[model samples]
Target: MQQRDSIVETRSFDHVPESERHGTVRTQVQFWFMVNATLITLFTGAVGPAMGLGLSWTLLAVVLGSVFGTLFQAFHGAQGPHMGLPQMIQSRVQFGSRGAVLPLAAATIVQFGFAIFFIQTASSSLAAITVDQIGLYDVLIGAVAVVLAIVGYNLLLRVEKFASYITLANLVLVTLAAVVVLPIGTMINNSAFEPVAFLAQFGAAATYQIAIAPIVSDYTRYLPSRTKGRAVSAAVFGGTLVSALWLESLGAALAIAMPDSDVITAIHDMGDSFGYGIGSVTMAVAVVACLITCSLSFYSGSVSFLSALEAFRTMKSTGKVRSVTIAIGGVIVIAGTLLLPADFLGAFTAFLSILGYFLIPWTAVNLTDYYIVRRGRYSITDILKPDGGIYGRWGVPGMISYALGFIAMVPFFSTAIYAGPVATALGGADIAFAVGLGISSCTYLLLTRRRDFSGEFDAVRAAPLNTLGEPQRSASASTDSMEGNIPV
Candidate 1:
């Protein structure tokens, strides 16, 4: 047994010289939990409501989105921890350092938008819960942003622990509600439980899946390489399958009881009546759980965008500067969410669609470069230095494949006009994301055959090798043993 370190440590991969330091198993598990929490929260607020209104097809649309979206995310996300770098750094192997910027920038902006969406959600909830005290909500959001910024990436682990407790408690309450309701004859015959057309069900499921695709990696990146496949399975199933079931069942039951109110209101109504003493508590728990989940969305968005900005070469160095950037970015996202009408959901979906468009091509390139082109092996050293790096300045094959993937999805997604018939047919604006993921994955694999971009492939490369200077071995490549300083 390669005795796993009890403490986190950065170690050089002997076989892959250019790879980034890898994450530990515990970090990976926490990451997976956070991913599940984030998805559950997002769906509860956005997609869950849609399903309540739309029913079967709405459920189906969200599910379909999961099928396609997860395929791309699992493949790409599984590649990250194995490589020990953000998706953008991994792209340099194929896109060339400069070429990688296009997709990185796109993903960053989209992620930032999501962060904004979360701030908007939490702030609105605070505002509503407090009777429209605008400044209070804004301050609350600002506080969260500042705290997250201060805590940095370590927050991913800490937040998950807090969220897990709330989620577990809520789960128990929901289960109890389910057990209690199942025996009631009235619950079975509720109007909200009425069956819907098959097509509509499919449409709803598709939309929900697309909406959550961009953030899949935010959680997946921390997964341990050894457990990557299983973690992906758990994340996709737990997040999409379990979440859909919870929301759908709740929606149906609530619909039957209220007959006309929204699902959240219905849930609240149940607390007033038969929920015994747990109704108010359940509602409160659910609201707080959703808020925590949204806060994570904003945090992950900040990380992704900050990573993108750092790629700019012109941005100031130091994680602190990046933290400040993330804080500012979070505020901007809130502003965008607020400036738009209360129908921010539609705009949010559109923004996500654009992100999906880019993520598809990017994921395709990532997976292809990792699995097929390199045959699941790469030098850690080549990644750091631009000139001597095996990836070279720009990989024409990767650039071509990425371009081809992007172009193919555009017409189907109708991204050129920011409107697609698929959205209309799908009954929500999430289909474009799925289409982009599928097209890009297949196209990239087809375009790039098993060809090596560079010859020398060693492990544990240094940073800023291109325009910066001669490649100095990163801390990982030092002769000193990496005992407890590995990055997650």
Candidate 2:
């Protein structure tokens, strides 16, 4: 058997070594399953219908959107082992090392925003149990999550695996509650498809899944390099798809059934339905689910923040300050949630909508650049030391393409804050995601069209394990590794 990398993952910014790449595909399945199976998703699930989509149509929209979005998330998940770097670090290949910071910062916000949303949702739901001690409840959940994240990657995976198993079973109670409130027949036969609402619902659902794109590789990077991409991708998609569909559908069902139900009311209603021991278990799962939700968001956010800024490079990338960063970030998110402008659902929906637009094109470009353009080969070692990674300081095409994608979405965007002119023309339908994905991907494809004839493959190779900070000496570095000469 191959030796393990370390008892714990010590190096954060560099390529994870082969010995360290000891996790199974099941890890990917469980980590992301627990990541998505949370109370906030249930809230996200309800937003689509609240936006005016019919329950039946909203459910379909959620499924279709989640499946399509997870395609990107799963693809990103597979890169973990191959590149042995964080997802944004691999992005340095598409957008140069320095250029990579844009997505990194954006992802930081996305993660922080999500952690905030989960805290607010969880705290609100616990009002019945805590009876007026809501602040204590919020702080306690956030504190536990920070501690879990501080314990670092292995513990995060372990907790998530356990959480996934328990949540899956406990979700049955939530599912049963849903069926009792809204029957299967009602979901299937009612066909009131509002296109605008359906599209918004789809965008929101897709955004929720895709927002994880920036950090997908964080958990997956521990797998062996030879691990089949299909396995990694399948594990993530299956777990995430099933969990999201269940909670999202459940949320939509309850929202439709009790249009006036608050977060606490929803939980109380479910618990009341199963008044025996099962009721207490259901309640406990809700609380645990809250910790799981914040743990992941804060965990990913902490890593993303540490890796994005060069100032933190001197600090040990792994265990040292990760928890500290997460704790500080958690407090900020909690404070912001309380001080924010609107209700939890309102603020969160807007946050998701805004984040989705930024993420769509970036994921599109990163995936296209890796799988299609470069066929997954990258200058792994060069990505470590920022002096002169094979990606160079900036790739005009990537930076320009990212901006163009964002600009293209302006007229196509649909949100509570602002609806673009095109979105207004389309009767408020939000097709920004589709437009941004296609435009950024097509633009990137066209710009790099010469790769088929160019000797670009000469510069595409993996770095040696644990050789992060050393000079770039991989086989790929022998070629003109810098992308400066690649004509746009």
Candidate 3:
């Protein structure tokens, strides 16, 4: 096990490296619990109600979307131990090594957006706690998260373990406070189903969960190689879902109970519901929760950026590469934050809808390729190699499916920037996310001809290499079971 003070993390790329894979499965659950049980999530959860779903339907959308989205995210996280690669890089088996860059770039953009989104969330939540110091709060939270990411992964795991407990308790207190003062009977009487609004919020809620797919493995990669895929999946699913449902449902409740105000304002009012000191404490805790989520945002943004470029492929997890990645990503996020509009609720919900448009197809294809087709086996060497290496630099099949999926769902996508005719016709409901997932998954399955079950789980190697990264004497029983013959 590497010690807590490993500075080599500065030069590392995405993966935790074989020598540093010392974390326990328990840490995986804790990391996610901390990641999901935070204010960004609370802000996101509240978006459905803010979208005009009222309370009842908003709550339903939160449950449906949270469950649906976390399935992909948790399953993706499972691949970390098996593949020893970050989530986006694992797509190389299907998209080919160089072609994989397309998705990597998409994932990076999502991460960058999320980093900014949550900072906005934090600053606003902080503004309620402090006296209109959102700018200072934003910079303060970003700097701390950047430093933590630069410190690297092991220390993060430790901090997250502790944060899980603190975050959960803080949220529970907020929930209780809100519930005690809320007029549930009146809010329930005011509730009624809005299909268009329900689906719109559903997509946003699910988008929040699925967006984590690109980064979940960044934390999961430290587990032992033989970790059970089912266990990893369940752990991630349980942790993410529990918190997502709770905070999001709470957000929905706040949206209805305090319709005139946004999440930040609602939260601030909740503090005011209690005495001033208690209110101040609750709001301050929310700021801390935002800070925790930002740490995750910064760390994963760095990992996604490094994973996109081939130059950082061989670097250690704690080396100069990682430090530089964090520093650069932080600067970009800070600059973007200053430049982008600070309409927290407006910007936050809008980004999620746009996010779903991208995530649905990518998550569909990646999950389909991994679990349904390949059954999770992948050749680490082939993934690292460049052009014509089994999965080559540019595989057209996966690329085509991804494009068609995007085109297929464009009609149902609804965003402030662009709304599809279908979305507009359906009273602004956004069903494009589901359409893309179904279309892409089925399309990829047909294109691959059920290759997942055909023993071609990952890229085929012309010559087998032993686990030691050296030439092997012969094929293993398991290797022989794999389909596809390569001439050596």
Q: For this target, which candidate reaches the highest TM-score against the unseen true structure?
A: 3
Q: How close is each model in CA RMSD to the real structure?
A: 7.4, 4.6, 4.0
TM-score between model 3 and native: 0.89
Q: Locate the minimum summed-lDDT window of 10 residues in model 3.
A: 465-474
Error of 2 at 307 (Å): 2.4
Cα RMSD, model 3: 4.0
Q: What lDDT tens digits, residue by residue, belong to model 3 across residues 1-488? A: 34446654542333344565677777777778777766556666665566566777777788888898888888887777766666777777777767777777777777767778777777776776558877777788888878877776777777788877877777777767777878766776777767777877787778778878878877787777667777888889988888888877777777777778776677667757854455566667666666767767777767666666763344444456667777888888877777777665465657655754666677788888776666555556666664525667776778778878989998887777788999899877667878888888888888988344323332232234312222333333355544322110
- Mind giving the per-residue lDDT tens digits that candidate 1 earns over 63-175? 55445544544455555445444445566677765667677677667666655555555555444334776555655665565555445445545666676667666656765
lDDT, model 3: 0.70
Model 1 segments more than 4 A misplaced: 1-31, 34-68, 127-130, 178-245, 248-262, 276-279, 314-317, 337-341, 382-388, 414-434, 450-488
Worst 10 residues of 2 by lDDT: 461-470
Residue 85's lDDT within candidate 3 is 69
Ranking by lDDT: 2, 3, 1
Residue 323's C-alpha lDDT in candidate 3? 72
C-alpha lDDT (0 to 100) for residue 420 of candidate 2: 95
